[model samples]
Target: MTDYVSTTPGLFPLPDWAKEDLSDLKGHQKGDLIGGDEDGEIAAAYEEARGEVIDRQREAGIDRIAEGQLRWDDMLAHPLAVHDAVETRGIVRYYDNNNFYREPVVSGDLDFSGDVASELEAASDRVEEGLQAVLPGPYSLADLATDEHYGDEAEFLAAIADFLAGEAEAFPDHETLFLLEPSLVESPPEDGEDERASEAIDEVASATDSEVVVQPYWGALEEKVYAHLLDADVDAVGFDFVSDREDNVYNLQEYGAPGSISLGLADGQNTLVEEPETIRERVEWIDDQLPVSAFETVYLTTNTETFYLPYAKFEAKLEALGEAAELAEVKAA
Candidate 1:
């Protein structure tokens, strides 16, 4: 029988201390943490250091451990690395204005430069276990880039979709591509806005054979978008539970039915440890509605990104999430 898998929410803000800890690892003793023209020794060391973090997460029983995006300066930088066509400037501090866990920003065009592909392959090779490469969703990236690059957001979004699809196509061997769309649940778009964005995302979804999971966070998902997502080629949809728990549960029932779901039950952005019982209860409710078999795969996740948290806080959150999963297995038994 296929066992039920418990995975934590993706994206944890990584503090300098965590970066330091990663640096101490053998393969990453000399690598750069935030990119730039750092020495090759620093780059290799830094990549290996991130692999250490992934190992820790797997040891904690996480089904899938993101590289913690430790290599990135910010979420936007991740896309910037792959798509070099756009000139990325730091404007409109993402965290300062938006209350996000970290600072991210607007960019120019979709540049699929293939900068990250090699690093991803290298990192994947370093890790003793399987790892996922997280990238911001094209729609969310387009929204962030709206005012900065193009006046026509729809056209820009379409370009981003094409860019992301190319990035996905570049990596054929990764187990899954965790495409994060924390902004997808933001303000409901105007009349046809939702449809336009959905079409763009569909292209990305269709471009790859690897599993594509659409993960939206920080806000409640609009019913229309949720409805449209159900019809996409996505393998699974992810939701944030620490913040918009109730609405997400409803969305899961109404729209996530019959689809694989990665439940975001941990707070990746905050330091507070989530209560295990709370997580178990939420899983039980979903389990009751969708047969455990239909539930297929219920992965645990943090609310947003965790790269901003201090090491103590990040470790606490990870530990707490692991506890919650342990409690879930006990209850399921």
Candidate 2:
């Protein structure tokens, strides 16, 4: 049986064809793409794009695949930013990167509007292998958005958590649910916030039968934050081994890794192609550093979204990751 799994955190780069189709819809409000005259055309493009992404992952021998999230123009904030109850505000810097996303401002009562669920359902129809669904974690969503309706921060966070839970419950076919939580690393929880954050994550995780992986990329998690994450009601925890390998290793050695851990070995932002041998060597090093049986299942993936790189480079990374996983499997055997 395969003890290790290979997958991505989702959000692949849009193919050229899809980009061309969406060109006309650029600058228009996200809601327009949902039900406007061009909606059918856009949906068809997304379907074609999903098929292409699935083909690439299958060709590269990826064990688990994602829906590619071709329609998520606002990155991880799409589920909330595109909702009818939320209004898109001015552009804001996305975490420490050069990329930006329109800020989501809560204008009315938050509820599940089915935008994300519809995307997942469409993509699921195209994928043949185990499908993984990706979404922004509640803590990260709350941090990225501006709350206008709910006056209290805690109340707003709880509401977002509930909304995410509803979304997760809608997708019962997903094999894995990746909750991307970059805010935990970008803005570490203060004092008592750790418990609150854990509870929020648990709220979302509890609603899904699929395995939940709380993946925080960009950098290593603070010691306190990592401790809190270990207590979260998720199946796996993903760490950014590419951006901050030293810190990640230190944390694993000192505090110990979760029973199920995903290591982001591929760098998603850079255009430089990595050698399969080099990636295999890094995986072996990580395996050697950790205590025996520290992790039950080790998932291999990119540290962040692959949308930052061009399609060619992204494909190369996928091939490299697959080759590395094969090598690691052979070594283990």
Candidate 3:
């Protein structure tokens, strides 16, 4: 029988203690002229900062931990460590205009010159054990990319998907699972846009061997989107149960294919903690319709990224979550 596993939404902000070093590195990576310290010093600080967050996660009893993304210059830059041609500096947003992301598209080819293996390895070592390395999905990348980048959007999407597939497969054995976050899934297109976007997503899902997860938060998934996912050959699908309505759960039960689901029970983006019994009750309700065995695992997580909250909030939220889990255990007893 497959064992149940748990995880959380990716990304954590740098703590105030580590802010200066993190900002220095960010400025250096972005080619900004910030006078503070040497790159080597900042690098050492980053390793320490990353370790601190990982330790906090372990203390919280989180099964899988991320390096709190302290090592990343930016969210997109995180993947740059693995793929080189895709320069973090290459991704420039057109912030002055409303169509900011519509800036000219850079090359979509795979660049593996700066493999993230070393960074991931270092992160693994710092955590005192192994943990899943997170990356954004190709579909989200393509959608988030500027239209100026390509003559053909479909072609670009396909190529990006292939590139991600290669990166996902190259990680060391310590990371048995890789998370491809497609946060853009929350913003469904008007009409024709949806079909084009779905095809791009299909390509990425087909490329990886690891358990591919499609996660959308802050909104409910549409029927067509759910149908598309049900047919995809992926390992699991994650939904924001904390934000999704009763109808959303009903739709999932009726249309979602029999597979593992990572349940987003806690609010990672906030300081408010949830009662584990409340979460258990929700899981039990879902279990009544779908056999427990149908799921490979039902992970509890925050609806969105936890880093958006402050460190104190994050700790408080974790404390609440720990209480909830304990309550669930007592009730189970």
Candidate 4:
């Protein structure tokens, strides 16, 4: 009875009205220097935008609703970017995509300042249940940053893991946390890093009771990396079925998967929307390959963030996912 479908974990594309309103208000665009809204005018606009994202997810029947990351500067660097000890430097291409993010330069000791907790708390006020949080995982955060303090890769990674753990501890109660760790796929770790990566992930997972899903996108991890990922204490691992699905399926068949898995059935980057029945068929195909008892719950989601797509396509994909989840659930029954 794997019957869960969730909003993709990251920034949802800003609506047209939001863009115009934000521009008129001189609001900071994501990846910009996140500014303070002293007069509460800019904050009001962001709140309204966040509310719309939540309402759309609810209408789409998403099981776990995200705050929509309306205030996020970017996924990987945001937490560190806001830290008092860190400085935002030149922009770098994010993974293999055209998108870019400010390189967070670590100048002093990294500390948690309830950066994401405020967003989660505000969203909690809007939705009575199923609210979720999104953050970059330690591995990716450390990998992407420019470390002027630690001076060592492993030490830097460990510090980041601990820093994020501190932030996770302060989060208000929520249903799920999507820890985006695309580095595992973009640049596989060197030998022995896998063990450290698992330990790092466990440190964060131990902080909160909410179910954590370590979602890697753009591609799948290699066998060794995937094996080590399974050793983590996280609740589930998300795979990008939209990109390099064969390798991901091979990893699952060879090493097996956790009882809970998030499958990316919808194409997040493409404009050609998938039909609900098409997505339902993809779920059925996955079930055929893996035993029924292989999973207690399977979460259907996008292979990547919907931020890349137009708002109309993004909403359509979400609606399709919700409908497909129902269809898949009925088939299992």
Comparison by lDDT, 2 against 3, better one: 2
What residue pairs are clashing in model 4? 31-73
**In candidate 4, what are the lDDT values of residues 1-333, reduced to their tens digit?**
455555576678877788777776775554354533324777887888889988998999888898887766555677887788888878788788877777889999987778788888889998888888888888988889989999998899999999999998998889889888889889888789987987898898888899899999889898899999899988889989888778988888898877789888898889899998998888777777775336877888888887778888988988998888887787777
> Which stretches of model 3 miss by more than 4 angstroms?
1-4, 24-38, 76-104, 113-116, 127-130, 147-149, 174-184, 189-209, 288-293, 319-333
Q: Alpha carbon lDDT of residue 64, candidate 4?
A: 87
By summed lDDT, the worst window of 10 consecutive residues in model 3 runs over 94-103
What tens-digit string does per-residue lDDT give for candidate 3 at 1-333?
334444565677666677765565565332232222237877787678778777777777666676565544434334532343442334354222211121224454554432445556677776655476666666566555543344576667666666666665565544334354444445555455556555655565555445556666666767776675556566666777777756457767788653677767777765666665676676666666664446655555676667557777776555555555444445444
Q: Against the true structure, what is each candidate's TM-score? A: 0.82, 0.94, 0.78, 0.95
Q: Lowest summed lDDT over 10 consecutive residues: which window, candidate 1? A: 95-104
Scored against the true structure, residue 197 in model 1 reaches a CA lDDT of 70
Q: Is candidate 1 or candidate 3 better by lDDT?
A: 1
Ranking by TM-score: 4, 2, 1, 3
lDDT of 2 by residue, 1-333 (tens): 336677888888887666766666464543233321237777677678888998999899887888888777788888887788898878888888777788889989888777778878887787755888898999999999999999998999999999999988888488889999989999888878877888899999998888889999889999888888778889888889888988888888888755688889889899997887888787888877884235677788899989788888989988998888887788777
Show model 4 residue runs off by greater than 4 Å. 27-39
- Pairs in clash, predicted candidate 2: none
Model 4 lDDT, full chain set? 0.82
Cα lDDT listed for each candidate:
0.64, 0.82, 0.57, 0.82
Q: How many clashes would you count in candidate 4?
A: 1
> Comparing candidate 1 with candidate 2, which one achieves the higher lDDT?
2
